[model samples]
Target: MTQATAQTRAFVTGFIPAIALLATVAPAHADLKICNRMSYVVEAAIGIDDKAATATRGWFRIDPAMCRVVLQGPLTADRILLNARALGVYGSSPIPQNGSDTLCIAPNDFVIAAARQCRQGQTAAPFTQITPTQADDGNQVAYLAEDSEYDDEQARLAGIQRLLVIAGYDAAPIDGVDGPKTQAALAAFLKSRGLSPEIVQSPNFFATMIDAVQAPSSTGLTWCNDTPHKVMAAVGTDDGKTVTSRGWYGIDPGKCLHPDVTGQPRQIFSFAEAVDADNRTIRLKDKPLNWGGATQLCTRESKFEINEQGDCGTRGLAATGFAAVDMSGGGKTLRFAMP
Candidate 1:
């Protein structure tokens, strides 16, 4: 009887045009329906090219053995694009995306047009392409069967890590790779909650972890190193009134680092720079392995704290883009997942 819902908005063809095929069989009352056959709660997004323009909509929550109407009324679009994710307590999407077509999506209800890039306050994510099946009732049906579940070992393990991080355990970035850090965190989590260690060896372990993390945590900013190299991270917080930035916290490979900052803020910003053991930048295609955002902030080379938000050059501090972290529904724990 537990029902959850996520809304995705669609833009009319007057905004952006679709690039795919047009629907050959358009029914007068055609609708788009999604059926969830998985054990976990899944949310879905869809893209449609209604012959004139292409627009997408989604994040509809479909519980196990349930079906949800994604698009109602006449079928207009010929081809469809979809993306689904298993929701976590902290808004961690552990479901493996299965497509290459990128689309722009907002964290909340949105109906954006001309979405080829990640605009301000929006993020670009990949979605799967699916063909709508013409039903006998003239509606479209899309099945989210168990076979579509990303049940790989690495994916399952990463799902557990994401849950652990949300539950106050420092599992870092929920990268689908088994490491010593993940193992230790998992063990500690099992013991602290009185969960039998044997559950770790079962297929239900991932589900168990997800259920346990429903309770919120009180932890602060944490950075997880998901790459092969060591990463140094910086953090910034704005408590609706003032801004404070701090950093140069080094985190080893496959490990997590919790900053000294305590209590939750309204917003958090993060910047990550990957380097070698001797503190040399690692570059791929001449670009340094780093993560940041469009929000310009003041930073320094060494461990430093900057209370002021402006006058970076004049004050002898370097300026960099600190990406805003979406804490997923104002959750207390803010984790900067570095890849």
Candidate 2:
């Protein structure tokens, strides 16, 4: 189905009750109304062409005899003309032919008429998509002339009331109902918050309130495990340390232990052949090279002797007889390695 056909079907299926209710209660002439028969409320207005009659949904009441409409919502006087179109009333449209011809009808009269018509298989006329008129005094005057065609001010008021609730303001529940109390409360809220006190334009006030409440905190580190699989240590000679006659040397275990240099210290002892915490013996020849010197002895140089059970005694090698001797004058390196 076409979009227009779909909309009409939806409106017929969905909105019959509200339209019916409106039809029953609205006065024929003085009471002008726009019933939001849809699931959502719509801002709207109503008027007749050539008649100064206008009715806004929640904000204004029209007196056809007086040729005047009293606005209770937050709309500027000028914008009211534009808002009337949404009420199914537009420039120079004749009064609805089916409704009562009372000189003045209550706002509810229009609502009830619309509702009754919609229920009895009447559909709103398809909207003619008119190009916006060129900016001319005549166009402007024509636009204003049609202002009385609908009750948009009331629709705007109803919308404002809904927005106020959504925005957390203490407004009355929307019942397609309006009164002095509702108007007074809205006026107070707008005045206190420095908004225009009128209903035609008050919807933005509530929108601003919602924004103010929500705007403050609208944008918001991670860790991972990096552990080692094995721990190792190394022993090497520095020029600053002393070397014994037996050529025994001690390197401090705590000073050079780190991931890059050596793994964590497993255990500490005096000789290259000492067993680690796991009870594995340190095999001197299999030990990886330490930072101090080359792993292999030079050609013709004696292989390094490592003492496994050496103690720092007055005579060291005589007690253990186990030491890695680098017969080359330069020192040999020792490190922890898998046996």
Candidate 3:
């Protein structure tokens, strides 16, 4: 099957919007609606505090140019907490989240009550506090748009880097800082696309790029680091017949990297090693600061991409245990998270 076909299947099986079909016109009833004006698919969660209990619910899939009434009926909560994530493998939710309120959310649909110290199987995702304006008709609408995309220089640069990543340019992480890696990636993208490098700063150019990179590609592998320290990752791919191993894709803390390789492979192997700012290997009570499994593949101390996977000694490469990844014969993303 094609990448598009695989993506459609994944969406059908995985994504479930918060609400059903949206009304053509805002309903006469007083309901809280979230309209996503951005170019990518978004998943939203809502937190309501009724004084009796504070509950957070989520995983509402909202597509581009669409709206959904996340909370039906009259807006009862005096203050509503909201959080949203870009519904994709890249996790590129560029919507500016403001406020200090935080909530617990699962990778899937969930409703959790205890906001603090989320129990087993749930991650703490920050939620933005939104004070919706009460309309004359007693309705509320929250528009998630990229109009005022960022309020700071760092955010602007990171936004650009995200677009570059979607457009198949491995610009480093969207770390909200314009570093050498980001600049180099931006320059390469501009040069290859035949666009002026200066246009990278233009809002109009940024909007256009967002539109172009909205749809994510289903091929290749993506590795995300959830640890606090920087991680160096190596991947081995098996196309059913032969296997190849590549190494040294440096990923910053809280960042992800999609190796600059193409095609859908049946099996993927990954091995990650983490280090601090001074390039010192981090160890917790003498345990190795790494993530790997039993699948062994060829690797070297330096950066290298080798075609053959066997005879590591003869080829002057060391054998490393890479965790075999189950792609399920399509696109997949593996996150290297801490315990």
Off by over 4 Å in 1: 1-29, 90-95, 135-138, 148-212, 216-339
TM-scores of the candidates in the order shown:
0.39, 0.20, 0.42
RMSD of each: 15.8, 37.5, 15.4
Best by TM-score: 3
lDDT by residue for model 3 over 1-339, one digit each (tens)? 233332222223222223222223333347887766554456888888776567888878765445677888876665577777653433312223454665666656888987656665555555666655444557776755554343235445655676677567667665656677877878876776578977865646754564444323354466777898767677788888888887665566666666545465677888887765333456788876888899879976544577877889887777889998776756567777776
Q: What lDDT does candidate 2 reach at residue 335? A: 39
Each model's lDDT comes to 0.60, 0.27, 0.62
Per-residue lDDT of candidate 2, residues 214-290 (tens digit): 22111100000111111222222212232222111211222111111112222212223232222133334775222
Q: Find the candidate with the highest lDDT and give its number.
A: 3
Per-residue CA lDDT of candidate 1, range 1-339, in tens?
001100111111001112221234334467778765444455677777556566766668665445678888866566577766554222212223546777876544566565566566555656667766776767777666443343334445555675676566667765656788888998888887798878877755655665555333444555666687766677788888778887655555665655444456788888877765335566778787788899888976544578888989899878889998877554444333434
Q: Which of the two, 1 or 3, has more TM-score?
A: 3
From the highest TM-score down, the ranking of the candidates is 3, 1, 2
